[model samples]
Target: MDHIKRPSLSGLTGKRHSSRDRSKDDAAKGKQKRADSPLIHGQQANGAPSPASRPAKAASTMSIVIESPPNIFFGTPTQSTGALFSGQLRIAVVEPEVTLQTFTMQLLATITARKPVAKDCPECAKKTTELFKWTFITDPKTLRAGDHSFPFSYLLPGHLPASTQGMLGNLEYHLDARATTRPTPSKGAEEITFRHPLPLSRALMPAPEKNSLRVFPPTNLTAHVTMSPTIYPIGESTVLMKLAGVTEKHEDHQQRWRLRKMSWRLEETEKMVSPACPRHAGKVGGEGRGIAHEDVRPLGQMELKEGWKSDFDDGNIEMEFRIRPSGHVRPLCDVDSPTGLSVTHSLVIELVVAEEWAWTKRPGVATPSGAARVLRAQFQVVVTERAGLGISWDEEQPPMYEDVPASPPLYPQSTAPERSTSTSHPHTAGSATPAVARAAAAMNGSGDMTPVVSAMGATQRPPMERRGVTTEYDGPPLYSPSVVPQAVPALNMGGLNDALPRDEDLEDIDLGESMRRPGPPSHRNSAS
Candidate 1:
């Protein structure tokens, strides 16, 4: 029994070592388990760590700028037609500078007349709304700015007060700019917002009226614009006159049978007759020479859209008209003289644009309909009246078309050689000779034709002698004498009859000296 209990010492040692190794392994496993446990930090053992949360963002501010045209020449319109107003304005963007984005500009005229309180609303509210009631008598919002120019030209219908179809009143416009979030928007889609409207008075509104030409409504209807000098040669002085008419009237009569409507026409005529009366251009022959009717047409139309309701016993109705000729129409005198030509500018236009010229009955104060509002029309009536030369008034003459004679054809010299040759060569002594020979012939005759025999002075020499012959210088003679012949050679050569000097040559000789003193002949007379 004692020996069994003792067992083997080596086995006991192995068991102890195995138990120690097991214990160390368990301890290491326990440490790893504790480190991997989710309960410690409340995080998954193998999951990714949560990302750090970020703070929210705030709103941003964007800057915008707009550019527009300059307003230099606004409100100084030189012409106006009843309801037709001709003026230019500058339009541009402010805040934001020039950009590729184009802006749409428009002109608006809001008119408010009499407004009655609504019966439905409470009296207090109705009175308030009625007090500040606003109706667009002439809403010209459709007019857009042309290009990028500021205060761009705003061509608006002269007719205003649509309710009564009346002409625009002494009107003024307020200019402003607006920014839209969605310039190009889809239907039913929400658009981002940007600029509201900022007043651009300087760029949009009419400039100061300091030197502005006055355009009174109704009475002063037509405006004639004459550019300084001539518009043909640019920079040249032109006079551009725009003529217009307005028919406004208030009867002094109790019945007030005043003129209701008015319209005008333009007729241009030219005077062919020269104004040279009593002088060069004034002769009777110059009359009606170049007279003719050039052209005639209406410049434009303006209408009396509306006016004071009843046939007023006072005040005047004025129609306005204007003309802007593109180029030079006629020459102006340097000395302020009149050109002759009367204008029969009498083509009555039954105011087309203006339905009614004048209304005697009280018209409904609201905006007038198309037919009722327009009571009168104004047209540019260019009289084209010519001031006659001097102070006289010349009647305009009809155009005369005269046939002009055709010029004779010029034949080439080569086509008529005989005629050309005859003209070039006459039957003169030098005609048959070549230029060189002609010159030689002139020199050869110079001896017999010696001029002013004594005027030759010291340059003269005795005639040369030869054996029964006299040989003169044959080489191209020196400069020929331009003077008329005075004397001929006196040397006697008998057989040289064929070349004998004529009686004309003898007359030219200084016979007085020769006869006074008979000089001794150096050479004997030549024998045939």
Candidate 2:
């Protein structure tokens, strides 16, 4: 039995070989199991979208750049109503050896009326109007891989409205460039496009004369408000308000009335005068496609000052009204920009007598239902940033719109003045009267000491210096004056040139020698 248990050598060798092969097979099975486990991939243990399932972005191979003049804009110069637009464009083919099917450089101005909503509705977003599309079109051509440029300039019609931005719509100008090419190996076409805004300002036009409109039935009132400089500083403004016929005279005693409320609001209105689609604009000039009225609440308020509160028969209420600067938008001057956009400000005055006094016990006297009188003094406001930006107020004078200077006048053609110590030789030329004398006379002639319109000049000006819309518009328009109020305070402020030199630039010039030169004999003596 023991001999039988002791197996043969060949049988023992076969058993050892079987054990080694089993060990190898176990190791291979373990490696395969580890590879099949879910941890190797990004798939979560719980069911969820994998990273590979996300969408892909379109590929691009070209770029563009725009370079505008030091001050890129199209605005009025000689005439207040016209506009001039000018700028430059630079484009570069970033990718190597890319053959483009078509490349274009263009400049366009479009006015759109859009409102961002909680959830975008494609239908509501379609309301828009193109006031005017002045396109600087370049020829379509194939471009070699290199840098390229296109220059553009536009002298818009003087009748063109100024640039305007409002809640209802925007009168925007932009420079756009695009390039299209079929990918080298890909099946479809790829495009590269770029767009940017252009800066422009419109000078608002005042009514032909000292215009006044009265609203009847709403408490039988008369109101006329004059903003000294129709263009006031950004923050606080001194308004010379003339409110007449506010209170009715009662015999026996002079009854005093209180202003229920006196306030002025900046009302922003954007109207789609012209619709994107002519037919869609419909009747009555795009009746209601994109009409927006944003009633800017009064940032600060006040009641009528004591003296002017009583029966105001042309009683002037000189009060300071403060308007807050818009944080989001440039509080532009009243300009009817080319796009169907008009930015305007209205000074609203609401006057109401106490209910008891209005409806007195005298029987059969029918007191009006709406007892409060609402009056609006609509005027163009140059809500400019120059004041806040600390721009040159001393050296460079702002434009004053009170009067128009003779256009295309010959400069330095007027007779020369005799050299004097005051350096006053009368800033203006040809006129017999000194500039200061003329300015003083004009100021005195206005009757009251208060200024009707503020001068956009230095406080120590020579005084004599003192000083359009719509497809056709119905109200006063806005303007920017830079004497740097240059002529702007005047023609939709065509940024007037600095007639006089600046102190900063003067720093570079040694005027001492020039000033002390042994001057020529007086022109008067020479002529004699």
Most TM-score-accurate candidate: 2
Q: Against the hidden true structure, what lDDT does model 1 obtain?
A: 0.30
Q: What is the C-alpha RMSD of each candidate to the true structure, in Å?
A: 32.3, 28.0
* Worst 10-residue lDDT window, candidate 2: 480-489
Candidate 2: tens digits of C-alpha lDDT, residues 238-335: 55555555455565322223355556555443344433344434432553453343435332334543434343333223333545444544454555
Model 2 error, position 392 (Å): 18
**TM-score of each candidate?**
0.18, 0.42
Backbone clashes under 3 angstroms, per model:
97, 30
Best by lDDT: 2
Candidate 2, position 195, lDDT: 71
Give one digit per residue, the lDDT tens place, for model 1 in 62-116. 2333343222221112321112122222333332322223233334432211211
The TM-score, computed over Cα atoms with residue i paired to residue i, of candidate 2 is 0.42
User: Which stretches of model 1 miss by more than 4 angstroms?
Assistant: 1-107, 112-528
